[model samples]
Target: MAQNLDDNYKIAYDNKAGFGKSPALVLIDFADAYFDPGCVLYAGVDDALASALRIREVAHDKGIPVILTEVTYQPGGRNGGRFFEKAKPLSCFVKGQKTAGFAEGLVPRDDEIIVSKQYPSAFFGTSLASTLTAMGIDNVVLTGLTTSGCVRASCVDSMSHGFITTVVRDACGDRHPAPHEANLFDMNAKYADVVSEAEIIAFFRSLKGEAHG
Candidate 1:
């Protein structure tokens, strides 16, 4: 572990992608399917949920755009394709299913943009990139479930789409710890800067000229 975090810092992972001028916060798939304890996809993400809510409140106060993502599949799972076949749990989002809805207390406001997606990457088959680009958003603060899946995909795609990406570590969870930690390390080393929920709140506060990080 030290070999990756401590030893690689000066050479293999020297770069630190910092903050940008304009930022938008995105909560990826904080839906019932992933939060319901009875659901197979549930990852016990209580801490992540609370962290996201806190960061979101700060972001909202700072006038930073808040974007929410939810997995939605068409009838008979036609929109899901291979991903659905691989993970049948995805069927939970089928059309009118209640599990497809956003979890309690995590619903998006009427003003916030909600990206309805059927894939891991929110940017795929969604208008999120163009919307952010139109709003002149140069940074993306990510929060969501299954850190190794949608969160990881969104983080990488955020970078590939030219945004200074920051993944809130405490606001992202996974079914298992290994993949979560591994992906966080990998994403920080290459795609996004992995930061804490408090750090992100500080960043938002700084934007409002309240306090500095």
Candidate 2:
């Protein structure tokens, strides 16, 4: 007989990971090149931006460690390696350019850490894994642009690094819905527990209470 998504897909990959006690908030590439309507890389997914802002508010309130990533490259894009060759859009991140910086309101404060990366996986050549480990972070909450690319890669790497990964579904977006939905579904099944922004906010609030009280 036929079955629903739950009985078929969900049951097999029924690993629903939970939020860890010490989870770091990772904002991935929420930069001008991705959000500006005038820019070619614009994803047309504004909901994710708003959700990410809300998530950031709670992250600050809870005093959670917030980390951010930027897709920056050198003057000739020499540091990006093969990735710099493949995506011409990466030229937007050349240093000293207007579009190379983080998007407004997504800026990192003095206390937060900003990890600049040249590839999709933030942990590849960066000190992300070691930084998280140093901070005693056992879980990672992800929010960012391009769900199918950097977000997906980071989720996989986060799990492989032995950290519980959680992707705020509404806080991530793609240039299109097809890859966006497909990647989120796959991440929930394997790499991360794709959850709603409300769920993530509740989790942050819970942590705030524990941290303060």
Candidate 3:
């Protein structure tokens, strides 16, 4: 008999890239576009954002660096390139649109960093990787909207850039459960260690006194 999917993948993809000594929490593209019911890009991902907020609180208390990402484009999406042309829904992110703003209660602190991009990966054409490396962050804990899009893209780039990447499953959302679950499974198997919010919170609490907010 053929092994189950999980059992079959366990043979080769079960290895874990555990948390490292230095870490940062990167919140990717949690914009109003995904939360606003009237918007075409609305994903009904409020629960995911709620879970991320909980993680953010603990991360701040633990003094772990928190980074936020946003997608933006100039008038008519002139800067979005082929991605904009391919996905008409990206028009919601045109500069100055309220839908493009960070979701409710997801504001960036004065000391936090915010990256703006026109592509899927937060690291693509952005200073995220360099900034994290400069600050000596060895592990990355990710939380964001659309697991199959920007979140997955950033996860791959995070590992490619040599960080111990971790994806908080409960804190990332997608338009549908199929892609969400599929991407999480693949990411856990090949790129990042897909974990839960509780696990991440426990890990953060364990790092007490290691850094300062």
Candidate with top TM-score is 3
Candidates 1 and 3 compared: the better one by TM-score is 3
lDDT by residue for model 2 over 71-182, one digit each (tens)? 8889999898989999889899999887889887776788788999999987989999999998788999999978999999999999999999999999999998889999
lDDT of 3 at 118: 99
Give model 2's TM-score versus the native structure: 0.93
RMSD to the true structure for each prediction, in A, is: 2.8, 2.1, 1.3
TM-score of each: 0.94, 0.93, 0.97
Clashing pairs in 3: none
Runs off by more than 4 Å, candidate 2: 1-6, 208-213
Per-residue accuracy of model 1 over 79-129 as CA lDDT, tens digit each: 898998898889889979989999888867977899999889999889999
Instruction: Sum up the clashes in candidate 1.
Output: 0
Q: Rank the candidates by lDDT, best first.
A: 3, 1, 2
Whole-model lDDT values for every prediction: 0.88, 0.87, 0.93
- Looking at model 1, residue 209 earns an lDDT score of 47
